[model samples]
Target: MNTLAFDTCFGACSVAVTWATPEGPRGAFRFERLERGHAERLMPLIADAMSEAPFDFSALQRLVVTTGPGTFTGQRVGIAAARALSLATGAPVASLPSLAVMAHTAAHQLKGETAGKTLAAAVDARRGEIYVQFFSGPDLAALDEPLLTTPEDAARRLAGRDVVAVGSGSQLLADGARAKGLSISVRLATLEPDVRFVPEAAIPTDFGVPRPLYLRPPDAKPQDGASLARVS
Candidate 1:
């Protein structure tokens, strides 16, 4: 089976195409970090990665996308692109949580015994809060519900626990944890979700319409004063 995965839910834009070969399953992936402009760059980047794999969209069996707990605009960009491609190609779509993708990446990177360590994935929410989640070891099982809170509150919740923080918000979370006298076994602050690892979070049987996983409501709201009354 051939699968394509892409993520634009945070600071990075990534794409990957995985296909089965006689030898084994193999993939081609492209990832780049940017402060903005995912809308402009994502398509070209995906094209590049697909070209490397030489995989055609018509042959895609599955399409996986990160339905974010990240930036609102970035999340929309990814889902819109995926949905459009799905409509054109007739491939089934799968949703992968962005935080879970990060956790999976962290767990996959761990070496040797990782029995008691928690994998904490976080993304900066841009108003001094973070989008966060926790998972247990390489299995990446959920340890808590997805959360949006101040870095300090998040740290307090994880106090006395051993963790490995990974994501854009890792440094801040690690700092908060240290203030609470918590132990962080490792910190991977520079890491961004790679689409190549997204398959780990894909739910084939639970497939449904993909949507942005915004834990908090949008910051911008329509101004009531400027709104005209609806014509009845």
Candidate 2:
């Protein structure tokens, strides 16, 4: 099966095309770091990937995307594009969470060093908040639910545990965690929680319901009459 996968849930945007073969999975093309203009760049990148690989759209077996707890706009753009492409080409679509991608990358790169310990994947959320998730072993079992919280709060929650922290939130969480007497070791990894490191195994067989994993309520919403009257 030939599959196209992408992620735009972090600071960088990435896309990859892979073909399944008897030898193993082979990547035809992989691109990353397009960043905030993912909506604009996504289609072109997909076209470029397909062009380089010379695969027929109708022959594509799956379209995979990173559904997120990252940037709201990026997640929408990526999933929308994936859905559209899937519909147009009549290919099945699958979605995986962004933190799962980070976990996969960390586990793959740090295979021998960690000796099968738990890893905390953290991504920077604006306003001093972070998106955090925990994984155990190479299979990436979830130890804690993903949350959006301040560094101190997160540190407190993860206190008294020996964990390897990876992501943008690692530095802040590590410092706070240590100050709070947590025995966690922070591992600074190059893999951002972005779509760039999405693994082939991360893709699901079924594209479940599309829902944004917002840890906190959105800032923008209809104002109450009291505030409106005060302003008026």
Candidate 3:
């Protein structure tokens, strides 16, 4: 199976491509951090990864991408790229939430440390809020839907369970837990999503087109009472 996956939901842009040769699965990847220029950096990064894999876009059998709860513009940057590529190459696209991707990363990086502990993945949604999801058990299955809420509320939502929190929102969750007498251990708190680990099932063969997962209304709104009258 030849697969392509990418993520641009938070502080980074990354691409991953894997193909099967007669020998085994071979892959290529690129990961970069650019909080403000993902739209410009993404495509070139992808092209370079494809070149390194010595494969063409037409070789892709499946595509994977992150849907958001992330920056409004950043979230769109990825979905737009994946959608355009799917249109051009005829490969199906599958989507996973950014927080779920973080959980996958935590599963890999924190390995043994995560034993018997829940995985708490969070994104700093600013305004004193966090985008979070919880995963539990050995396979790290998600325990519930992703959500947007205050750090304190997120802390309360953990229900006093021990969790290994990962992502930019770690400190806020940690602080909230402290204030509420709940506690969580934070790891890879500064990490961004890596396309290399976007959860294998996230790119299933029977896939639908990916879409943005913005949890809240955009911060940019049409100016109040500032629109000119439309003429017929």
| RMSD of each candidate relative to the true structure | 2.3, 4.1, 2.1
Q: lDDT (CA) for every model shown?
A: 0.81, 0.75, 0.85
Best prediction by lDDT: 3
Total clashing pairs for each candidate: 0, 0, 0
Error of 1 at 124 (Å): 2.2
What candidate 2 gets wrong by more than 4 Å, as runs, is: 194-199, 222-232
Candidate 3 residue-wise lDDT, 1-232, digit = tens: 7888888899999889988888877899999988799999999989888998766888788788888878888889999998999999998888878887778777888778998998889989888899998989877788988899998998998866988889999889889998999888988988887868754554545578777877898778779998788899
Using alpha carbons, what is the TM-score of model 1? 0.89
**Candidate 1, after superposition: displacement of residue 172 in Å?**
2.3
lDDT of 2 by residue, 1-232 (tens): 7888888788767778878678887775555664579798878888877886647788888888887887878888988888788778888778777888888777767776555676888887878888888877656777777888887788887755667888888887787787777767777645665344555555677765456666667778767664554564
In model 2, the clashing pairs are none
Candidate with better lDDT, 2 vs 3 = 3
The CA lDDT at 199 in model 2 is: 59
Cα deviation in Å at residue 1, candidate 2? Answer: 2.1
TM-score ranking from best candidate downward: 3, 1, 2
